[model samples]
Target: MDYQPDGQTPYQNTHSQNMALASLILGTLALLTCGCIYFAVVCASLGIIFALLSKGGSLTMNTSGKIGLVLSSLGLAFTLLLYIGLFLYVLKTYGGFDGFMQESLNFYGVDSIEELYQMMGVPY
Candidate 1:
């Protein structure tokens, strides 16, 4: 039976706000799980979005949501970059780059990278 002078009722209740905060907490926990980088990233992104939206919608923004957003985003970015770097390292270690360079050189009738190195006058 809460009333406002403007005859408008608040759209959110304490329970709903608490639930939202809990959701944010749970999402954050899920993000921290091992091998769940993608999931964590997604959860964090959603949490941030939800938190911002809740703030705009006149819902209280909890501290947990803020922390979760920051942690999750960082975790996601770090994990994503790490995964990309790992894949790149694997590709490079497996001779992917060297093979491609060798094929290109063969097309140009070069016997070795050393020949190109010599032509470029670059020391080994």
Candidate 2:
């Protein structure tokens, strides 16, 4: 029942596990840097990619790598949800930057801030 070549079983490479661990760390960093929208999104994306790749690397069996993959996936999901929620809240509150700017301009009866300044003839 022993399936070993030359009476020595090959050891599993630890690189995949290390990659998964790194993915988890990056995911955690992304979650913490939620305020920086772009950075958080990018980090979360990379984390998810690394986790998936690690998971796909082997299916024979792995404990540490599996754990790292799971953690990284969860972290990625959490960060993605947080980013989506933040985006929705911003959209609902202000419509968007363009809408908010247009509203401001309409309120002042000006096409833009520049027009307002021109109307006032204030040297800038």
Candidate 3:
């Protein structure tokens, strides 16, 4: 048992504080920027790394570190799924923005975007 000079048990923080803080910061950034695909994944990965390191090679983990780990994992998964879904949607919409615009114009019976612009008398 651990006791302090005042005859009361004092709680000592033995967890890896630096790693926990890093994990939390990265996890938060990842969660906030989930739309950024590669960037979010990278941040979440770094957060997960720091969180695991905070465990200090033991079965026990600090509360903050565990929270950081969970947040990082969730952010990573969410961002990855978001990226993949957006990628597939882009593919379905067309190869690129130009193609998407062209397809939309075609659907409206317009032969080309240039012709539509010409009809509107808008300078290209």
Give the top-scoring candidate (TM-score).
3
* Tens-place lDDT digits, model 3, residues 24-86: 999988899988888889999999999989987567988778888988998999998987888
Ranking 1 against 2 by TM-score, winner: 2
Q: List candidate 1 stretches off by more than 4 Å.
A: 1-16, 19-23, 58-61, 96-124
**Model 3 lDDT, residue 116, Cα:** 87
Ten-residue stretch with the least lDDT total in model 3: 7-16
- Report the backbone clash tally of model 3: 0
Error of 1 at 64 (Å): 2.5
Residues 1-124, model 1: lDDT tens digits: 5456677874433333554575477456545652566666666666666556545444455666566556556656666776778768867765677766777788767798888778778898
Q: What is the lDDT of every predicted structure here?
A: 0.62, 0.67, 0.85
Q: Stretches of candidate 3 above 4 Å error?
A: 1-14, 95-124
TM-score of each: 0.48, 0.55, 0.64
Candidate 2 residue pairs in backbone clash: none
| lDDT for residue 124 in candidate 3, whole number 0-100 | 100
lDDT of 2 by residue, 6-115 (tens): 86776544346666776777677776776676776677677767766665545542454455455546656666788789778778877986877788788889997889
**Candidates sorted by TM-score, descending order?**
3, 2, 1
